[model samples]
Target: MGIVVVEICDSNFLLSLNIEEIIESKYPEVAVLFNDCLGFCGLCRLKPYAMVNGKRIHGKTPEECLEKIKEAIEAELAFYA
Candidate 1:
């Protein structure tokens, strides 16, 4: 399988989690990047926003987005695995 890249932008604690660090530490095959804006202002206004493999996810809290991202990533991984 290929690398799974999760791009997060302009979030509060979600960005603070150092997602890149966490992903690199736990799943070396996964690459996480943090940016300023994802060009989805509506979603950004929701606070925690992330792009998992090019799919946009917006939520009120980091935890909310994190759960969804994990599920999505796992599903994607399972497909290729």
Candidate 2:
């Protein structure tokens, strides 16, 4: 995989997965940042999601969002392949 930019909400209560660790271990090339807020507090406060390559990937739960994010990452990396 190539460079994947991910930004996630810093609130632990809202997410069901340890996003940073999961992606770091599985996709070493991805650069993920956890911020206090991504200016999408309204959405971030409601669902589990990540901004992958600037695209918003969302899911009702963390596991689902993580999978979606991974798919998005693969798709973006494919462009470089």
RMSD per model, one decimal: 2.4, 2.2
Model 2 residue 8 CA deviation (Å) reads 0.4
The model with the greatest lDDT is 2
lDDT of 2 by residue, 13-62 (tens): 33566677888788888888888888875787788888888898988777
TM-scores, each model vs. reference: 0.76, 0.86
Candidate 1 local lDDT, 2-81, one digit each (tens):
37878877644577566666556766667787788777766665577678789876566777777777777787677778
Candidate 1 lDDT at 52 equals 78
Weakest 10 consecutive residues, lDDT, candidate 1? 10-19
Superposed model 2: Cα runs more than 4 Å off: 12-14
Name the TM-score of candidate 1. 0.76
Per-model C-alpha lDDT, please? 0.71, 0.79
